[model samples]
Target: MSRQHLASALILLAISVALLGALQLALVLPGSDVPAVLALFTIAACVYAAAGIFAWWRRPTNAMGMLITLGGFALLIAGLGNATVAPLEIVGAVFSTAIFAVIVHLLLAFPSGRLDSPSAAATVIGGYVVALPLQLPFVFASADSREFAVASTTQRIAGAAIMISAAAILTNRLVRAQPRTRRILLPLYSYGVIAVLAVPATSLVFTTLGVRGGVAMPVIQLIVLTGVPLAFTAGVLSGSFARTGEIIQLSEWLGASDSRRGPLTAALAHTLGDSSVQLAFRLDKSDSYVDEHGTPVKLHSDTRHRGQVAITTNEREIAVIGYDTQLTARDEDVRRAGQVVAIAIDRTRLANELIAAQRDVVASRARLVDAADQERFRIAQNLHDGIQVQLVLLALEAQQLANASDTPRNVSTRATELRKRIDAAAGDLRRLVHDVVPLALLQRGLVAAVEDLVDRMPIPTDLVTEHENPALTSTVENTAYFVIAEALANTVKHSGATSASVRIDSNPERVFLEVKDNGRGGAVAGKRGLGGLADRVDALGGHFSIDSVPANGTRLIVELPCG
Candidate 1:
């Protein structure tokens, strides 16, 4: 509880105690002449009842609060009619009993963490009913005399039992509930103390008054009789109005719009500080989930928007902001305060996806650039290693022939050797053009083109495929052709094994091609021709991975996204 609330409670307590004590004294000592004391008690009871009712009617406020105020009024009336033990005394007695019953109910209703659970609700109600009859005898002692006294004392015991149970329930439940405030306990304790004091005080006042004036004017009795009822009614009205303000705030934040709704919402937000609020946004009111914090959270799913809507109301009337957050905080004040500070958080998840795509695009372009340069270098090397050497040998042979005799057999032999050299050069040129852009890729589909590569491989090989594919885009077909060519070349040059296998597969989402060789499996990607081939595949946005373990043959798998 805040200091102000605590102070108010203490003040009320002191006043009630003092007034009851003074009335008791006035009854014992005849010359005290304290009519003002009686009036003060009446006023106190009235005010207390009003405050109690006001508190009770507040939204989320317990019914027990109303009962406490009512109980006080009962005591107030009973004390006022000490001399005339007529309707006032009887009514006062009934009020006092009601006060006890209501106080018990309120204390039980005091929200303890899990103690306010449905099961606990039942237990609390049941406990109150069972313990109530024990106090019955204390209300009406020995019907023969019809006198009020502590002759039974059962009411006190019952009250004590209720206090203990309420305390135990509150302690156990509040720990789990993690309530934000301890303000409620004040009222419970206050009503208990007042009720206890009033009972004994009333007994003493009436008993002594019977001995004087043949019937003493019951100053305390008069106050208790009138004050308690009036106070209770006022309190209920005020508390209800306060609660209405709160509910209006919730509705506004919820974003409800009715003729009266908007005003109520605005008023509530103003009353509660810093509230992030959603006004009248419909939610399923059923669907719930466990949040990241492991809290069992529920969301209103019935609405069109399934997510939570929150509002933050600031000190400024016009600047109410909204956001998403939890609503488990028990203090209405804190919830209002949170509204003021909460900010709109933007999640750019879509931007992150674009960044990833850009990275892939850049990486693919770089690989294509490198592959082009590498292919040019390979063609140059082939000329130097094969065709150019053959040309040189032919030149040397021609010179020797010229220096030898001009005979038919020697001339014919030289001419035949010259033809062989020319043929070799023509073959090299054709091979170079084919490597640049295989014509087979255009005339035949990917499978046919790949089969041509397998046919050329020197090693024993098996080709397994179930081909049901659309006519691939030119770029896709070219990429596939080169991949198979590179795999075949690698197997021939490096595997040094008896067998190899090539498999092609496709699905709606992607195309998959794998080449496996039973050779010394240490074939790493990006080594020799294989690296250039892998780069070619990358330019087409396909993934390339080579699993080449020490004793296991290499498996080169490429997965290309088609969709």
Candidate 2:
């Protein structure tokens, strides 16, 4: 057994010894009601002691366990009240009221052992003063002594004061506690209410009815005492199961594959049974916090409605979980769930980071493709407006010189050759302009432009359209056309291809294009024009890949989103 269990075993042995001593004292006492009085003390002592031991064994860390243990010890000390020895009787009388103080302490500090606030501390302090210091003066007084009246009056005043304080504290706690916390505290509150009423009721009974009241007082005390410990134990058991059950359910929920349906805050709220729960992740680099979507969120104290708990890993705070303020009464439950919450928050942060990275890559690629497109447009415009116009003027001037009647035969022949050369240069410029930004692609569509391109190939080529062309955005059409053009060019230049086939297939969601060459196959992805083609496709949220086998042929595929 552990040291805690050993200590509990030792305490149980001491209680048993004290119970035997109380039994012996009852046998020796002279009064007719001695057995009944001793029975009340013995039963209270046995029940509270057993309850304390059980609590201590079950939850060693909770202050409730030690507080309950102390209550039981106080009852054992109270059992010394009827000892035959005068000194022992005086000691017992001085301390017998201490058990009532302990009960008040236990009720105020249920679930958690520490007195959490100034008001709670003051209440416990007052109970101790009334139960111990105020009762000291009555310790040595005999029942018939002149001082007995003063002692009795002081006892009634102190008892009434302690009971009133306990009632106020219990009422304040219940009023402020949340639904879940109030449920856990219900049993203890019931015990407090009964104790609050029973203390004064017993006094009134003894004062008004005399002998009959004396006959009923022990029975009343026994019932109240027995009920208090039982209620406290019941509350402890219920709270433990409720907390454990929530943790188990949360574990199972998080373990499933489709756990990403809701945000981290919703999952935590459901797990903690607090619908108002909010999660904020700490950004260590910025010394700030953000919600799960990465929007900045400021945290502040609002104890009336919400409570905050920090979640940490590796000794550093990773996030904060804000829950219902009423849960502050059971702060330990929140603390225990912190590890699971931290893991979930960390996972969400990583997923958000991955999405952000992909977004950045797509945006960067789009900017690159836009720059390339602008450069192509500028070159095409210059060829058509400046160089082609100048070439045409040169061709017209040479033709006019060649046709002049006053020109010599040699000069006319030279001018005719110069005109032919100028016309040829103009034709080359026109072809370059067409290659830079194909007019057909902009005016007609992807299919017509690709078909026009394949007809001009140096080797035999086939263009097949699997579906009638649907209207598409300019980016999609331009990207698909360029991907096919680059792949066919690469096949002609590097693959030593004699023939090639281009296929276009389309659906509502996306368009698929495939280019295959019947040539010596040695194609690599992200090489030569393939890399530029891949970038263009990626800019339009498309996929590009190359498959090649040495003996077979190269196949380039592009998939572009159309809708």
Candidate 3:
């Protein structure tokens, strides 16, 4: 035990001895031989004190322990009334009529430890007002005096009224409580309420029934009054068992929930019975926190009446769960509740991270693809406007010189030969510009481009189409063309093939393409042409595959999303 617990134990031990002495004195000095009633009071005080200490250690945030402990001490003090010393007797007389009033206060506060409603607060205040102040008026008076009789009778009548009022308030509160809350409180009501109300009623009702001054009253009072402390202890144990079940159920619920059911934060709060529960994830490589949407959240460590549990995985602080202390009662319970959902929280955080990384890769690929396309456009324009135009002018000038009437025969022949060479060079340059940009694919799309392409191939090829695509994004169209071009190039260079075939299936959402050739193929992916092609296709969220066997023909399949 810590210093705090040791000191508390010592103080309670001293109080127990004192109350034991008071019990002996009250039993011996009494006018009546009602040892059972006196003994029950002393035992009830010690029992209530033990229950209070247990609660205090378990739920330091709750006030119920302090109140129960106060009731126990008051019972001990009131028993001092039986002492022969005048000061001790006066002290006891002042408190003897008020013991029932303290019981009313303790019961009204119950498991939550705080009086929530106005009626509960008023009843406790009124009980003290009537039970304590009325006794003071007759404290110094003679036993036979009119004032003593009036004050004593008035206090009992008022005390009885407050007790009844308190009982009604408790009944209404219990009735209004929700189903889950009612289950937690029902034990206290079933046992403690009966015990608390019967404490005073036995002295009043049992007398008429001819049992109050007999052997039965003492036994009846002892049993009923003892139930008060026992009921609370039962409530605590029952709550713990119920909470364990809830924690288990919480894991099951989270494992099954999806978008329609809501997020984990809401589920955790509901499971723990504390609505003010908060969950936030820690940023990677930083001591900061963020929500699922990546919104930065401040974890207020200094906030009052709230406690936090840091959830860790792989020696990293992945998330934190903060809960209301007054509402939750125990930090260990919150930590246990967090343990139940640690895996779920970590999964969510990792998923968010992967999604973010994939998004960045996609964006970078798009930039690269767009930059390469723009550079191709620039080169194609330069070949057409500058080099091709200059070559055409040279061919025209050479033709004019060769056709001139004053030109020599040798000069004419040489100029004609030079003109033919210029025309041929310009033709080669035009073909190079076409390869760079593939204007037909941009203007006429995949079908027309492939038709023109296979017609120029050195080997015989077939083209098959299912749905001529309506339209597609430039990125998707570009990647599709590249897969076909690169696959055909690989077939030409590596495969000893005589024929090739191209197949296309297109829809609004996606386009599928297949290129197969009858060749002695032993092809593999991640090679020269296919490696770069695969990366380009993946950047656009597409799939690329190459199938080849030594005897079987090679086939390249590409699927590109349209939108």
**The best candidate in terms of TM-score:** 2
**lDDT per residue (tens digit) for residues 1-563 in model 3:** 44366458747765775666566555445674765666666777777767766665554444666666666677677777766678877888788756566667777876556676798999999988886778897788888999889987987788778878887987787799788877766666656556656756777787677663566765787667666765665554356533443465576666674754567787777656666788888767777676766556887677788888888877777889888876676777777777787888888777656665676787788778778877888889999999999999999999999999999999999999999999999999998888776878879887888888888878998989995685787777777777888788878888989999999898788899999999988888765678887888888778888889887989999888776
- Which stretches of model 1 miss by more than 4 angstroms? 1-420, 470-473, 536-541
Tens digits of per-residue lDDT, candidate 1, 399-515, equal 566456674786868776776676567577667757765656657788877777778778878888875775555556566667777877877887776798999888776778888
User: Which residue window of length 10 is worst by lDDT in model 2?
Assistant: 240-249
For residue 403, what is the lDDT in candidate 1? 55
Q: How many residue pairs clash per model?
A: 64, 0, 0
- Which candidate, 2 or 3, would have the higher lDDT against the true structure? 3
Error of 1 at 102 (Å): 21
Task: Tell me the lDDT of model 1 at 165.
Answer: 60
Rank candidates by TM-score, best first.
2, 3, 1
Off by over 4 Å in 3: 1-246, 250-339, 458-460, 466-473, 506-511, 525-527, 538-541, 561-563
For model 2, state the Cα shift of residue 201 in Å.
Answer: 37
Better of 1 and 2 by lDDT: 2
Model 3 clash pairs are none
User: What is the TM-score of each predicted model, taking all chains together?
Assistant: 0.38, 0.47, 0.47
Better of 2 and 3 by TM-score: 2
RMSD per candidate (Å) reads: 17.9, 19.6, 19.3
